[model samples]
Every structure is written in structure tokens, then in C-alpha cells.
Target chain A: MSDSPDSAKKKILLIDDEPFITSLMAMNLEDSGRYEVREQNDSLKALETIMDFVPDLVVLDVMMPDLDGADIIYRLKNDARLKHIAVVFHTATVREAELHAHGGIISGFPFLAKPATTDQMIEFIEKHLPK
Target chain B: MNSVPPDSPPPAQSTLQQLEEGGALSQFASSIAHEVCNPLSQIVLATDLLAGPQPMTDEFRKKIITFLRQGADRIEKAMKSMLQTCAPIETSMVAEDANVLIETALASLTVDASVRVEKHFASDLSSILIDKKHMTEAVAAIFANALDAMQPSGGTLTITTYAKVFTSSEREGWQRQSWFRAGDHAVVIEIADTGHGIHKSQMPLIFEAFYTTKVAGKGAGLGLTVAKKVVDLHHGRLEIDNRPEGGVLAVLTLKSAAKPATFLSQPLP
Candidate 1:
């Protein structure tokens, strides 16, 4: 019943408190023609949006107002229906040097420092998205 | 009973050394990098889209250009705020009306229309010795923080100024310094906002450099730190606490230049 990989655009949901970052990243990913992108600017509503969108992967920001990336991940992992979705942190809270020192993993999740190019984002998505 | 000998020299650790040892400097550096990176991320993505092979419409091109400019402006703003927070502030002290300074600070900001400003100034308020420009900046910073908290769904901002004689009990609550005494006359400026109050856990960290509860790219998180520095330069006390009903209350107390008997005899009505 599943669509073929070539026919289906990969769904990627980006959750960041900054509208500018989310809007820019969404445009960049959509322009590639290989992915479908949705952005959630409010961390509090991120969980509900993620469940509704049913994205293949979620790119999250670490620091937000009410809810943070870690908290969202915790919620996702706790949910039986949502735990299977792939997740990665894209945050400015940690320095690039710190990410490198930690071998690109933070709190047991794949991580990307901010100021990353669209190419870097696509590369990370391709490497992590489940087949 | 255990204390350094009265004749003993103070510890040799400089403020910079202490900051470095405590990892404050590293934290400060990381915060600055974080602030810059948020805008830099947008810039990178915007430029990449512009350079990509995909056909771009005129509307999309204009949007990308706007974002590029916004990102650059954010970076410039962050750099300027950081410099203002860290640089040594030169102050020229003069006797000025607290009400005038508050009004001047308010005039500098473009406040939202939804937010109502209520001023309750004392008619017999005493004049305070302060650097008018620096004090205005300090007051404006506090006002800015209040306004930020009440954004989108605006609220009330209440400002009150009065003269007082610091009692022993009140002096104990403020910073312990030789410059201010229990009987000293002072002018008090209280700015209260009707917005979501700060969490109890965050109370201690609110004054720390680069500590902010706001979303990234909105601010550099140096407003309170700079405000505190300005108050310190004037040998004054600044205190912030959550209000009982709701929101936050910031109090700025400065030594008054007017005679205590004159100002205190006629209390604020």
C-alpha cells in the first residue's frame, strides 16, 4: 500500500522558535524538489503539529520559550506511535567546536550546529532518514 | 568569628581571572556566538536559495533579499548590544529630576499601542544625583524588558517614583555596601508590568550576562546586565522580583540630593 520512494517526497518538519530561520530553511528544502517541508514556530504546539504532519524526520531547536528540543524528544520517545520517527537537533545553543568534540551527537541524538548551509542540511537528512 | 586579618591584603584574583576560572567568560563567548549564529544561519540559507539552480520568481527574490538584510541587521545589532554591555561606561553626574529621566527614557522607545503606561509620580519627589544619559539608558533597558514580556497580547506598565529614607530592615535586603546607610535619603523608581511572571528557578540567573528567556535573534540578553552596571556606577541599588498578583516589579533606588526633612515631610499622596 506504500508509495514508491521515487514517487513520494520525503516529509521533513522543522521546529524552531525563530520564524525567520524556519521560513528560510523551509524555502531552501522545498526548492530542492525532493522534500516536503512544514514549519512550527511555537514550541508549545510543536508536538501536536508533529503528530498531525506525521513527518519522516524532525529538525528541532534546543532553546525555546515554553518547550525545548530535549523536552520534545522526551515526549516523542515516550509516545508509542511517534517514537519511530527520526529526529535531529539543529541548534545555536551549542558551539560547532563542542559538536565536533562530541562527535556530532548530543544527549544521544544526531546534532547540527546553526549557520549550516542547505547542502549540509540535505546531507544530514539523507544520512539519517530511515529507509 | 573566622575572617581575614584586618591588616591582610585582599586576595590577588582579578575580576577577569575569577570570571575565567568560573567559566563565565566561556559562557559569555558561547552566548555571543549563539546570538550571531541564529542570524548567520538565516543568511546562509537565504544566500544558498538565491544561488541555487531553481527558477526564482520576482516575489521570492524580493523575500530572499529582505531576509538577507534582516540577518545582517540582526548581527550588527547583537554586536552593538554586546559592546554596550561590556564597555566601561563614562558618566557625568548631575542633580536631575527622576521624573524627567523616566519620561526621557520612555520617549526614546516606540511602545506598542495595546500596552497602557500608567505613571504615578510623587509631587514632592526629591532630586537624585545621577548621570542623566546613563540613567536614562538604564531605565530604558528595564522598560524594554517589560515591553518585550507583554508583546503580541499587550498589558499594563505601571511606573511610580517616590522619596524614602532607607530603614535598617530595608537596607539589609539590598546589596551590602558602605556607600549607603540605613538613614540615608533615597529616590525610588518602581516599574511594574502585567505580564507573565518569571519562574522562581530563573530569578537568580536573570541578572547574569547573556541569560534570556526569549527566542534567539530577538535580543542579545545583555539588557539587565547593562542596567545593573549603570546602577552600580551611580552607587545605587537595583532589585527585581515577581509581583504578588502577576508579572514583574523592578525597583531602582538612588541616593537623593534633596534634604530629607523636606521630601519626607510631604509623603506621596
Candidate 2:
């Protein structure tokens, strides 16, 4: 999959309002060594970071202080360049039952619950990584 | 030294109690400030400690993580409650069974082991149109009050619901019970507790905004007020009163769904 030097590790962008959640998740993702993760504690700055970093996958929080995960997804879906980038919603607000009710995904993006085990996150990360 | 008469009544007061329209905002901010900040502090402390880790066992790590999550959940609760007090943003209503709602509300509660809930739901009870989340919070407010009151004594909490056809005379019993139109059918729910009842003097003030008998931090005194507003939004009536013998009883009556009480052919949730 990695035909180029820069596309070696999967690039990840984590957006959440809570510093603890973003900071801890970033540390955990980077520690896995398969991901190059960048954390944004403010949801408002998501667009700027996404433009600059151009992540392969985005992990967004559903309920945030400024803009929610759905808002970010809308932005991603509209842009021509970013529309194809994979997205996974990570939230405590929306439950698995609710997710399934909406057809196993939110706006065509897979989701993982907050407080997910590191293993569970790893599996999700791997499934969405570029092949 | 001036010795006032022990039995002398207090100074004259206004008969009509008026809560300043904006009083709740300051009180809400005051309470929520602590609620949000404390959790943030815990998360910060735990993350800082867990950082530059030098020898932390899995158990310790789990304990810290638990604290962080719990704090986050508490912050969510406080903010949610505060938001509910403001006004309804958008209410998504659907036909839902009251029994299910009661169960959802009870499940939402973090009741102590000492508290127990007993349900007596009429099998033929009709469904009601409600926004699931808002209704759950409204019902859970009463359930939580009962739990908080009975936590020390470990008493039984009884919840009962039934379909009631309102007669004109019965409608007269409740002032402005228009939520259930006269001669229309409605769903009635009663939640009662074996805990000590509210004081006779305090009963009148119980639902007043920011009026609470609980010490600071235990509650913001907005539960009943928010519950009342949500019930009103649903075109329902909310009542809180003392039981004849002992305890507190909260009754909620809502307009039943248009359809008659019948199970779905395929059983939908």
C-alpha cells in the first residue's frame, strides 16, 4: 500500500473538545506506531488542520464545545478533495443501538463509542486505513 | 438584650411567590461552574499523573481512567440539566409506551443499592406521543428525587401507570389540566416513595425555580421545574404531592396517542 515515502503510516486527525480525550487518544494512537495522529482539542480548528495535514482518516467527537461531529462531517462531505477521505465518529452521545437504528453508520461514516478499549480502537483504525 | 417572643409570627410576606425571571440563570451558572470545573480538574489531574509514567500498575491506570470518565459523565449531566431548563429546542415526538419510558428513566438513574423500584404497568395502557429523551429526563427527575430521599432509609419506590378516561368532573379536580382534553383518554403515571415526606411549609416552594431543601451541590433545584416544563410541552400535567400516610407521590398525566391500545403486529421497539 505504501508506494511513497510519506504515505508510510496512516495519517489520523483526532478532533474532540475534551483535552483528556484527545490527548490520551493521540498518545495511544501514536504508541501503536501504525498511525501518525494529530490531536485538535478545539472543534473549530478542524478545517484548518485537515487542510494542512490532509489525514487519511478523521476521528471526530459527536458532542463538542464549538461544532459537533456532524457539522465537521458535512464540511468534509462538501469539499471535493476531502470528500473521499475516510471518517469514523467516536462519541459518547450516540450509542450503538442508535447507530444501528441509523443503519450502522452516521452519514456514511463508521462510529466507535467513547471509552472504547485500545484493542477495539486498533481494530477500527486498521479497518479504515488505506490498503 | 432584646428578647423576641418565641411564638411571634415572622414579618408579613407576599402571599404570591414570584421567582425573578432571570434568577435561575445566576443560580444555574453558580452550580454548573462547580459541576463542570471539578470534573475538568479531575481529568486534568489524572492525565497529568498518568503522563511521563514511571511504574503505574494496570489497576491504578484503570482507577484514573474511571475517574476521568465519571467526571466527564457528571459534566454532561450538569450541562444537560441546565440546557433542559432553558427551553425546548426541537422536540422529536413518536408513539412510545409509557412503561418503556418508565424503564428508560429508571435505567438512566444511578440509584444506590438501598433503593428499590417496583412497577405496576397496566398491560393495556395506551402509548403517548413524546420526545423520548425529554420524557426520560422528566420522568427520571421524579425517580431520582425518590431515590435521593430514600437512600438513607432504603425504601421501596413504586411506579404505576394506567389509562384513564377523563370525565368532566374528574377534569375539574385538576386546575388547567387541558393537556388531557375534557372527555378524552389520557395516560396517568404515579411515582411514590416511602421516604420522609416534604415539610408542609416547604411543599409550596418545592417546584419554585432554584428552591431546594437539599444542601448546595446535591441539586440545583431545577429538576421539578424542568420536569414541569417538559410535561407542559408534551401537553401533559405534572403534579407532586405528599402521600396521605407518608412519603412523596408524583403524578404525571399525558394525552394518549390517537391509536387505541394494541400491540404492533410485528412488535416494534
Candidate 3:
């Protein structure tokens, strides 16, 4: 990742249960050298990782075991400090509209589907993140 | 069996009898379909209500919708099974790999993760001429039965296929006619499940229509029946035998449609 002496590089967290998919994403994103990519498979430790890593963008999966992505979005959106950090939901879930209509305002800033391409994820981050 | 009398109250009477029989079967199937569809409609309605733009703090609505979708799929399958049993199967022939078909069916099932699935297939085997949908349904039913036998509590499921030659001795009284010669080539597909083995007494009637060991609403006891019908439609023989290890083995023997060839060798032990 390209980081200036004065500013840190943008960090992206990719959370998903499927190992093959997440590893593929992490490899692709890390190889890009534009953004630092971190992966979390454990849903329970997701919030802790977010707090510790302080990622610029969070990529969340929906069909996780303990906690779902939508619920995590709700929690993140409710927190004052984390609210500013852009969350991009990535899941194989059946319904996307309901997640978008969280109390008339979508909690997750952007949503993406599973098996997403490299260009799509980067475009989402670029569009949503502050300059 | 008594044949229809020659007088037969004219051809119209026979036509009327056939029509009545067909109508009765259709009505019975439609009634079952209606019963299944009513609850499905309710689930859809419930989802619509839950998805209303109104505010709700709890997230149980999504869970309920998922449950309803699963329930609706199961019921839809049951109704289709019943309807299939009452009608003659219509098959469309295609070149299909048996191993691939079995794997696809297994993947689509909502089986328990604990159950072990093992596949032993002959890679050099020729493509079989069969209807993909009916074959898939038949394989899925057998797999579902195996899963039911081994889920929550785990067990191994083995699927194997190979070429074989059958004799009258092998079929015995099961064959309606002795059409088999000494060297009739056939393909055998075996599905073995390690559930609670079938009791000795229930063995004879397990595949009979309307005979089920499952409780009410859990199953209509038609899985094996429909499976057998599909096999028969494919000009195949469905055989069931108790496994030595404590389970059931369902073997389907389909006449080889590929070029005729002698048996290469018995599978390695």
C-alpha cells in the first residue's frame, strides 16, 4: 500500500465466513497496492477487529453464524465514533432491499453482493469515502 | 387378473370409467396441492406484512420469512411428489454423467453438516441416456432418506456406480418376464445410507405406495414409491437390500443404452 509520511494508507476490512472467497478477496485487494486489506472470518470478533484496526471501510457479510451483517451495520451506525466510517455490506443473503430500508435510512453506506469483482469493491470505496 | 369383459357396456362405458379414474386422481392431487398452497400464501402474506415500511426494532421478521420459505419449499416438494406418483412419468433423454448428477443433487440438499457424504464413481464410464430432472429427483429422494436416517446423529452415505451383467437368478421372481440373457449389460447405481436399519418386517413393504414409517405430516410415505416409479419409467429395476453394517442400500439397474460391450472386470474389493 502507498502511504505518505504524513498520512496512513486506507485500510479495508473484509469479513466473510467462506474461507475460499475471503482469502481470494484479500489476495486480490492486497496485490492492488492501493489499499491495505485485512480479513476476519469470525463474526463474534468482527466488532473487536473493527475497533482495533480502525479501518477506513468495512466490508461485512450477511449469512454469518452468530451475528448477521445487517445487525452489525445497525450497531456501527448507532455508535457515534464509528458512524463516520463507511460500511459496505457484502453478503449472499436473499433480501437486500429490507437491509437498505433500515428505518427509512440505510445503515450501511454501500452494499455489494458475493463473488464481487475487484473493480466493483474499489469503485464502491472510492465513491463513498471522503477525500 | 380378470380382464375387462368383452361386452363392457360398449366403448363409451370404458371411456367413462377411465375419465372418472383420471378425475378422481386429479382431484385428490389438487386437494393435496391446495392444502400445501394455503399455508404458503399465508407465509407470503406474513412476509409482506413484516416488510411494511413501518418501523420495527426487532429483526425476527427476516428469520420468520426464511423459515416460511423453507417450509413452503418442503410442502411444494411433497405436493409434487404426490402428483408425480399419480401420473405416468414423461422422460426426456439426454447425455448426462451419473457422477456429476449425483453430486449436483447432493449439493442442493439441505442436509445436516455432520453427515458424511462419500462418492465412488467410475471416471471412464459412458454417458447415460436419462431425464435429468427425474433422475435428480430420484437421487435426491434417496439422499434425503439417507440424511433423515443419519442427521443430528451422524452416519456415512456412499454412492457408487458401475457396469454389470444380470441373470434371471439375480432378478428371480422380481422380474415380470425372463427377458434377460446370460450377457445383458446393465449399469448399477447404489445409494447406501447408515440410518437406523430397516426392521426385518418392514423390508418387504417399504417401497409400497402409501406405506410410510414417518409420523403424520412429516412424510406421506411416498418417497420410495415415487423413486420406484421413476426407475420403472426409465426401464430400470429398483432393488433394496439391508446393509451388513446397519443401513439400507437402494440399487437401480438401468439397461445400458451405450454401445454393447462385455464386462471389463469386477470392481476392486
Candidate 4:
């Protein structure tokens, strides 16, 4: 919100099939003035959006129809340009209980369950992103 | 006519049976949870935004409130459909015959003329308490699967209707180790086909929501789920097995209407 022309603002991409969740996260992150955010509902268009936005962090959903988060991450890992982009799987596909059951880890990344408060999502981003 | 006694509770079933039922329900609930949570997450964020220390004009506050209300209504609508699928149909249960129900389901199917239709209904088959429309749809779903399995090449669709008392253990044994209730006087409907049989491993997973072996667009994987739910609601069970020689045999059992009591009275001299 503040136009201070600071380079410190982190760029974040929120991708999920649910448009409402993306909108909510986008609004919260943008309002904080701490991140430049892009929201993509269609996972197939995720790469195109990433190319256009070139975000610092990506919040990917795992159960998307066009492409699952794991597949997207695999593609990202293969590509040099997008390989460095940090991703946190925020989804209902692998629930919180499942992660806990498996000793608190899934896909070797910080995971956040759906119906999460904005604070929890922001906290995860802050922890993962370089200060 | 006998009614369920007011003070008497229905007999308790095995934990295994309960577990199977729970699995079916939890699978369905997970789908609902995802849909419901999407809207719920929005409401949580919008409310947070409004309640936060950020300065907002009255118009903006109104907008946020509108989104909140919309999210709430969306959750309600999703939950209503979820409940509708699983809820008992109190008024629709009537004393209906299984033979008639099977015929009605068969008639509704869009089967090719080459597919042979065979019906063997017992003459004295007892009436069942069921919702006619749903029961028909459930049978229709099984038939749809049979038709798919034997596609292009035709097959015999042998449907047999008979009445029998099956103990819970017997139903369990019949499935070559499976699960269901203990005892019931049910009008059993067995629909057999001559098509390729189901893979044994996939049998248990078939009732699970979204567990589909069919190619995409050909199936939503809800047919068997709906059938199971319907049978459960009608106080019955559904079993699908591979026939020894070939193809699949799907058996549906529904509790029959209670037989009238015949009383003997002393005659006056």
C-alpha cells in the first residue's frame, strides 16, 4: 500500500483452484505492503503467471485439476530460472492430521492446511523468506 | 403389524461393520470439507481484515461484510447437499416389491437391444420398505457398470429376486471375507453379468468416493457410492463380487415389511 519505492518487498504467488482463497490471501499479503502478489486459479497457467510475475515465493495447492503441486514443483525443479523459487504447499489434499501422523513433514516443505488464518500463512511466508 | 418398540434399541453391529460405514462417510466428508473450507477460509480472512487495526471506510466495511455473508451462505448450501445425500428419507419408505423395483430400474437404463434381459422374480417375494425412486437409481447404477464392463460386445444381464434371512456372519462369509450387518429378513436382488469381472483388489476401494478405475469423463466414481448410501439408508447392504465363471454379481438386500401375526382364539361351545 505504501509507495516508498523500496526493493525490500517480497513477491509472492498464490495458486489454488478456489478463487476465493487466492483472493483472500492476495488481499491480505498486498495490504501488508510486504509483498508483491499474483494469484492463479488454473494450475496450467501457473508457469505463465510465474514467468510474468517472477515471484520470490510461490504458495502452491496440491490437488489442482490441471496440474498438481508436486508436478508443478517437479517442473520448477527442472527449470533453472524457476528452480530457486521457494514454495510452500498450502492445501487440503494432504491434511494437517496426515502430516502429523507422518511425523510433521510432507514433500520436504513447510505445509499449511486449508481454512488457515491469514496470520498463519503470513507467519509461514515470513519464516521461509529471507528477511 | 409390529412396530419397533419405543424403549428397545436396535441391535449393535460389529466394530468392523461400523468401521466400513465410517470409512464411506469420512471419504464423503473429506470432499465436503474441501468445498466448505474454501468459503470458510475467505470468511476468516475477511473478518480478520475488518477486525484488524487498518483504517477502512464504511463502504469498504460493508463490502467485506457482504463477502462474509456470501461465504456463510455458500457453506450452508454445500452442507445441505452433503446432508441430502446421506440423510434418511423418513416419508419415502413404503412397502414396495423388489421385482417391480428391478424392472423399473432396468426400463430406465439406455441399454443396447443386443443386451439380453432376464428376470427371475419369486412369486411370493415379500414387499420392502424403501424409497422407490432412490432404490431404482441404485439398481440402475449397478446395471450401468455391467453395461460398461461388457461394452460393444453384448452380455446376459440376469437379474434374480428372492427373499431370504441372512445372518451377518453368512453375508460376511459369502463375500470371501467382507463386512455387513448380522441378521435381516431382506428381499435380496442379485444382478449377474457375463462381462469381465472386477479386479479383486479394487473391490473394497470401489465404494470409496472418487476412487475410479474408469477413464476420466466416463466416470465421477459416485455411482456405487450413491448406491451404498441408498442401501444403508434403507437398512440394508450391497455386495459386489466376481462370479466364479466370469463377470460381476452385485447383490442388494433391503429389509422386508414385517409379516402379519396370525392369532388363534378359543371357540365358544
List A-chain TM-scores for all predictions.
0.85, 0.83, 0.81, 0.83
Candidate 1's residue-wise lDDT over B203-242, tens digit each? 8768767778887666667888778767876668899999
For candidate 1 chain B, the 10 contiguous residues with the lowest summed lDDT are B1-10
For candidate 1, list the clashing residue pairs, or say none: none
C-alpha root-mean-square deviation, candidate 1: 7.1
| Predicted complexes: DockQ each | 0.64, 0.02, 0.01, 0.29
Interface RMSD of 1: 1.8
Q: In candidate 3, what are the lDDT values of residues B1-269, reduced to their tens digit?
A: 11222321111122123325434444334335433543443354345445444354467556556656765765677666665565555566665667777887887798677888788887666555667788888878878877887755888899998876665434533434324456666677899988887777567656654445552245656777677656655557778888998888988776665533222454556
**How would you encode candidate 3's per-residue C-alpha lDDT over A87-110 as one tens digit per residue?**
777654323333454563544256
Measured by TM-score, the strongest candidate is 1
TM-score of each: 0.82, 0.47, 0.46, 0.55
Model 4 TM-score, 2 decimals: 0.55
State the C-alpha lDDT per candidate.
0.81, 0.69, 0.63, 0.71
Candidate 4 per-residue lDDT over residues B77-188, each given as its tens digit? 7666555555544335566767888878888988887688788888776677666787788889889988877777888889898877666555433332233345546678
Interface RMSD, per-candidate values to 1 decimal: 1.8, 10.7, 17.7, 5.5
Model 4, residue B108: C-alpha shift (Å): 14
Model 1 complex DockQ against the native: 0.64
| Candidates sorted on DockQ, descending | 1, 4, 2, 3
Global lDDT of model 4: 0.71
